[model samples]
Target: MTPRPTKKSPDRGDARIRLLEAARDIIRAKGFAATSVDDLCKAAEVTKGAFFHHFKSKEDLGVAAAEFWAETTSSLFVNAPYHQPADPLDRVLAYIAFRKAIIQGDLAEFTCLAGTMIQEVHASSDPIREACGRAILGHADTLVADIEAARQAHDIEGDWTAESLARHTQTVLQGAFILAKAGNDPEIARESLDHLDRYVRQLFKLTEENKC
Candidate 1:
């Protein structure tokens, strides 16, 4: 979640913000099915009344949390250094490098909340699942312009479109997070991204030094 503007209360304004923050962290750690309204209330230090005041139900809050995840992470990537490169291929590689660089903290800290939530609730709740799908695909869509530009610049031909390749990055990332969590090692995630970086370079016929 974005930084809270103030430490105000539910009645004073910020109950909704607190609840979304609590849901993002706790849901990533515990899975959406396992995280209850009470758990969120306790984590946010808000009461049941406050939670319901902000959200009609836990499912409602789940959807809101996914939207919140998209908003905050979108801001993070928009201002990221990867976008500074003049070469589209360089920008793509830098994106992969940036993903690798940020895998330095706890699983919940760096892993995606939308990815985690969707895996748990996709089968049961359409609303939450759709929210997660939007968050994941929306972020993936941001990469399409760079990927397509690189393809065009190199006159590259492939069976894949920029849209599919962009989504593939998220696929690799989500899988990498799962493997890292299962093995309790962040290196596993980094290794997966290394392979993703190589794949992108190979697709564009670019050498390591070509990255700007």
Candidate 2:
């Protein structure tokens, strides 16, 4: 949902793709446990037989949905406006800006699927949980290279590693989504991102007047 631009697609794709797309949106909105196979099938306009043909069980579909989320979202980041800046730190800050920029429409419209699924299924469903872990951590990992680049470029030295801070960005982001979901306000999430921006600036010894 972070990309927000392509909120929903036409129902022109094949059954498997249609189901995966439905799961992506439905699970983000309804939570993994509450969204049943029938709900997904109805949304995707597919039959139960088609659902089972593509996925063995709901758990299997959960895993596939996490994987699908990872695949679809990574492309958004790769070509995002965040990468336009010259300085690595600027790029990092731009990445945050891009994140905030995309937090539009309803809360469910912009929530993170992996973050949502992992929280719901971590204890009860290991396959889904692990799949979510890979999606979340994989996204976190994407930030490492840019973060490390910014660290080296700025000559930043700290007890913290780029890897940890990169992971932390996701931590704050996911937490923001959780708050927004509970509060029924998207601003709650954007406000957390505001703090995230300030925290990252603080980490890099940036005063407000001089921050990227």
Best by lDDT: 1
Computed on alpha carbons, the lDDT of every model, listed in order, comes to: 0.88, 0.88
* lDDT score, candidate 2: 0.88
Collision count of model 1 = 0
lDDT of 2 by residue, 25-78 (tens): 888888888999999998888889989999999999999989988998888889
In angstroms, how far off is 162's CA in candidate 2?
0.4
User: How far in Å is the alpha carbon of 151 misplaced in model 1?
Assistant: 0.8
How does model 1 score by TM-score?
0.93
- Prediction 2 TM-score vs. true: 0.93
Q: Looking at model 2, which ten-residue stretch has the lowest summed lDDT?
A: 1-10
